[model samples]
Target: MSAVSESISRRVTLGYIASHYGFELEPRFADGVTVTSVADTPDSVRPGALYVLRDDEEPSWLSVAVSRGAYAVLVPPSMAASARSAGVPALLATPDKATLGALAADIAGTPANTMAVFVVCGVEDDEIQADVVRVADFLHMLGNPVGIVSASGSSSLERELDMSYPLGILDIQHLLAVCSEDGAAAMVISADSQTLRPGALEGVNVDVLGTIEQLDRGGSQRAFKETRQRYGFSIDEQKRLVTCTEESGWLAGQASASRDLQSQRRLSLAIAMAMDAGVRRSNIRNALRVSKEMR
Candidate 1:
């Protein structure tokens, strides 16, 4: 085939052994017929597909003839000697799994759910698109909706979804991008499932590990009691005041006031951590105000 036609017609079906060293199946035929290893069972072998067999178990002469539709066979690196002795077209190498996976995703237009993993570095204003994409794909596969957790950080996922959180804090908008409606509901329940605490990301499926800590520290019922005690406000009167405030506005005021000294301290510490983690100050403040302690 001409270079241009070859480029257009050729599709890659590379088989990687490890994370590093491997080979791409070069199709010699236009009919999508190729050969592979015996490790790939008969069920996996498609009629028109290429099968590259590694040379783990081989009665060489018979193995070659038995691969009915296989146009060729790949000998494993372990069986390089046997393959060379048998004069089989065997590739002798391994490849990086991560790199191979990345390439596979690029070629296949989608990634597998089993390999869905995320790595979140420190929060930078710069978008972390890769992580968001993985999250989005995973949630979509599970038929779940996203749930945004208010935090002092920008959500790359939210941006990818073209949604924005109001009140200058990261809201459920981020979750919306990663998961669908049902998924988001699951996330909310998961986040609230555990009691609030520092560095507590028990069930929350967020990339930002600190958001859990922030939510825990900001938990209203415990936080309000502590804050009121430290500020020397009358617990009953403060409760009434917070209730009245809730009726007017500032629904989280009561919860914010009710927290104990430790809780408030943890909240402050969490804010500082979020700031250090690259969360914006405005977002941090807004997140601090979202609470269920209003009454």
Candidate 2:
């Protein structure tokens, strides 16, 4: 996998990493050392790479990493002395998994910052996935190259879906960087409650965050409220689907009585989001007609 984007030719330095994350450097002079890559395992280490030693790992891994040409090491406070005695540059701190993910994104040039990112989080996994696919289809019809990272896998218009690993902040950033490099204008990510824990998306630059579930006025829906945009969908007595957004006015459309309520709600929210993203109403109507005919 490409560790850094080709468009981003700039390299990161150990000093910058240390200062940015408030990590203490063993040898202050080693701050100037440049880091070309990041690795968690000794076998993955390459020249000029910064190897991160997790708290549970043995201190011996630090020496092994250094011997394999690791330019710097990030170790827990307990291993600071060992790192110092190993005669290698060391960053002293035991960052949590989420913080490490943020650090990795920084080292990779923070590619997510360059594109529009939309996150879909809901209680149901299948609903989240369906919404993500429909949103991607709408964005593609709108003439924007869209990237998608869902529970199924990561893919874009230019790349096939790859299901090599579970979703994590690191993998998400890596896919985002690749999508950015491939010139994707927008990205849609699907997440469930389990993946929306504290700090899980710390470094991701999310533009729109929406959920498929109904919005409760009470604090029970606190997680859904903590976003730049909140979209709620409902079916009226007339059987018309409606989506209300904070920034945009309500969008309503006739719903098919034969269709499931949840499916109609998902499509309604997707249409509202696509319209908010600048898709013309006429074009959406045309697309809907074509979609109906195809079905």
Candidate 3:
């Protein structure tokens, strides 16, 4: 197991998290404090686990919880000073939840950085699903074990991928954290991207999907070509691929005669995405026919 997988398996120390945030730990709760996980609700608290609390939450309850078994507390923003004064044993403080998540993952050593991180950023909801299928399928075919960070909403793709993550806990920080995970192939979808911060993953090469060229960049053509060469994609298949490569191309073609394929339980969304991108359904069927699953 990797550092991240191992981290998840074992408990981490409060000093570890504080070190990542560059915060000095109070001597009282400084060393020998180990946490199992980041607790969401107080009821799920485990011995030596960290939990973040809002300023408005009941401090008495938090105090009581810590007294019982909680490892450490991260006071939100201004409350940290106050929390410290109140003897909360606040190990670290941060206003931004995203920042907190990033710091925590940094201490714990996330495994996403080692994987292929793909994001379908800066697009509308309608345009996202089709692109997700294309890019994810492309990664799947490249012999990577795909782990999808499904940002809620889309039901079909969520059900289709066995290893899927719910969008509720996924933020930019979470995405960045996951990007560090080893042996990971991730795809994230978002409806809006106008204000996406500059230099956000600037140096990183993410296969941003949603356009025809983007589709090809994400390995749609590669998968298609490999499939075609192995069997044979004739003129009809070639024509189909051309027609559907662009969002406008396929959206317009699929507009009049729309097929709601959610009804088919066994059908992989990867196949749907390929077909939506203009690979002939027959060609996809052929590719699957020669594969172990189809056999």
Candidate 4:
């Protein structure tokens, strides 16, 4: 049920979304009409959209989506049974199911393999990547294709980005989905006061919350690095590539060699951070070029 790398059959049907969500389509809608797109809420519904109705809030909008030519409706069991009995094309699953997160992540892809979440703090907004422009600038210098999920729409990322999430509304469920896509080397989500502060990440997965902070990036690198295990990073001791993580072994450990000591240090840190952040190894080399020093 993965959204990426999973072979999708042509001719999407209601049965598809149903089976993916652990639901059974009733006999009336068993055959199911095909769907071209999906709209999780009623207002966002488009013609031929598959409406994923939220908990009992069945506003009259469901009928509106259907009237506007939505192919089918996906809902929890109580509503589904009612709809089916009334001849509405709906499928059913339990209400407030625990498997919803698992289902969403399953379709989005495993975050562990494809995503990186960071929570950087301990500095003023000016000193750290405080805005989208600085964040995008930092990412560009890091040399890996990256996405920005921002709350305030002031970053260069606000204009254009490989992938963008507005208002920093990204969750593991959504993030896993983004990471499951092709060309997605890494998904670097911006941390805000809401996410970076205490108790913000109370219920979040530690694996996803497992952070890589303490960026000692100076001048060039404002560097990025990853940590998976001991003896993995390519940095030499006191200018030598030492600490190697699963991600730090990239480029055969060439992150240590550079003419400019500052550039070497920065690029080394950048490579490691990008890799740690889930940037693809192949893409890391290009991002290693120092673009600008942190101001």
Candidate 5:
């Protein structure tokens, strides 16, 4: 089995979840019951998993999850009575997307806390992918194992990113845990507006944030200045690379040139993010040289 699979196999007890997230437990005795996985649909429930029922779901599905040997259930307040009478460990909570994310992260051991997590957002899908690739390549060249999670897919330098859950808090946290288990020192997550919604990133630690400049693409006038001022770096449009105003000459010619404006902007943002993560100037220069030679 892969490292992530191995990590997923690790179990957590209902009591731990309740205590960690401050959820009210029904029938107090179910605390000792262990859950190996979490599922939203009854069809996905395993023998020792916890099934979270949404408010929109039919009440009858609760029995279905119980029949499938779900060790525990996290249900909406309205279902508390039904869950209590179902003869299993029950947790009373909102069961919203954010709540599920927090639960999933807890179950996965909250791995994002273990390494530097860089976030890339506010850009197109292709640009996000390009930025992620650049960041991952730079980190890997510096001898730090890195993991990547993008809208297209998830991967790590050491192995393929395998996940059974959908791309939400659960899948993302699980992937981060897997990367941590596989010894990744850092990770890059490509997030769009959907993924940036209120509860999407719950329990994950984001160390740095970067956004591609879209000034000429009808972006807000304050976008470029705000990002540069906040992050201390900006794209030098004339040179097609990043300029770190805080550390003059830090990345002079270390960035690889790109003709496409979008690619250049993404590349510049990626380099700036790497700099924020404290990558040494010498390492950046060497990584750039190595990347150029390989192209």
Candidate 6:
């Protein structure tokens, strides 16, 4: 898996929010590799890897996390100070509001897309920290998930951290679900399921539907074009329907109205099938009612 994907699999990670305003950094060396490491101090550093910093008194990890072309560094204020003094450009201190905003901007390279880094260890006075809220908001706005480690030592958090990397065992079920039947639809709907509308259903598998539409709008005048172009319909049968409908234009209009009714029936049938597949009857019923109105 790619480094970004791998990084995403981990629930809680340690990285700093760099302050952009203070310093201009130039790469001292290019490691030409990607590594994943977790360390308590500078010695835990790998030249080309992403490192997670463990809480330590010395703050040596801060220097290493930011140095040698590292992706980011995580440190408390005391350690961040020392790292800054040592010329670590991308250092971020815990629980600092103004600093996190400045640091988030630096990491993302744009003011709008503030990315978040989840810290495995809890910050001091996290209960009242506005920076944590900002971090959550920033991640949320970007539709990114950031899992921070709390001092509570919650097992849930620990499980999340272990599986946050790409293709981790914990994420396999999600991956499989996305790759299954209606998987493409599942992906689109699941991503923004709360906001999905019937109109947006066409977007669920846009590439597939778009190709069908392109075939319908052929250069030559062809019969049965619309039906053949629609999803889940075949060309010959579509042609026959069109031919029959055209033979009786007046009756075809009435038939068109009936066709809509039939489509609603089919949709209702689909909902019933879903209900049979273990969806709650109420949900299926509501969905069918909503689909009818949408139609």
Flag the better candidate by TM-score, 3 or 4: 3
Judged by whole-model lDDT over C-alpha atoms, candidate 2 comes out at 0.67
Cα RMSD to native, each candidate? Answer: 17.7, 6.5, 11.7, 10.2, 6.5, 19.4
**Which of candidates 3 and 6 is the stronger one according to lDDT?**
3
What is the TM-score of each predicted model, taking all chains together?
A: 0.29, 0.77, 0.52, 0.51, 0.76, 0.24
* Per-residue alpha-carbon lDDT of candidate 3 for residues 1-295, written as tens digits (9 for 90 to 100): 0111223424666676667566656654565676665544465455565666655677655665576456677665555565565554566455354454454454444433444444443225334455554556554553445545444332222243222222222233334344433345454343222313322222222333233223444365564444333221122342222223333343333322325433121124344344543456555544544453433
Better of 1 and 6 by lDDT: 1
Error of 1 at 128 (Å): 21
Which runs in model 2 stand beyond 4 Å of their true positions? 1-9, 67-69, 85-87, 96-101, 161-165, 193-198, 219-221, 225-261, 276-283, 286-295
lDDT of 1 by residue, 108-179 (tens): 222112121222222231222222332233333233333322222323233332322221111121132233
Model 5, span 10-120: residue lDDT tens: 688888888888888887787888888777778767788788886888877888989987888888777888887777878988855555666677677778878888766
Residue range 1-295, candidate 2, lDDT tens digits: 3233223324688899889999998788888898877777787677777888867788888889899888888888888888987778899998876577678788777777887777776667777788888778767766689998876656866687654344455455567777887889999877654333334455676666666566654532465454322222111122211133432222224523334656566666777766655568887777776666666
Candidate with better TM-score, 2 vs 3: 2
Q: lDDT for each of the candidates?
A: 0.30, 0.67, 0.43, 0.41, 0.65, 0.28
Lowest summed lDDT across 10 adjacent residues in model 1 is found at 1-10
**Which residue runs of candidate 6 sit more than 4 Å off their true CA positions?**
1-57, 63-69, 84-87, 96-295
Quantify how close model 3 is to the true structure by its C-alpha RMSD in Å.
11.7
Q: Over 4 Å off in model 5, which ranges?
A: 1-10, 95-99, 162-166, 193-198, 214-261
Best by lDDT: 2
Candidate 6 — worst ten consecutive residues by lDDT sum?
A: 203-212
Tens-place lDDT digits, model 6, residues 1-295: 1122222222222222122233222222322222232222354344433333435455554555557444444455445556555453333334232333232222222211121112101113332122233222322222333332222211121132232221211122222222231112111011111211112111011111011011233421342333223211112222221111122233223223355543333233223223222346455344434534555
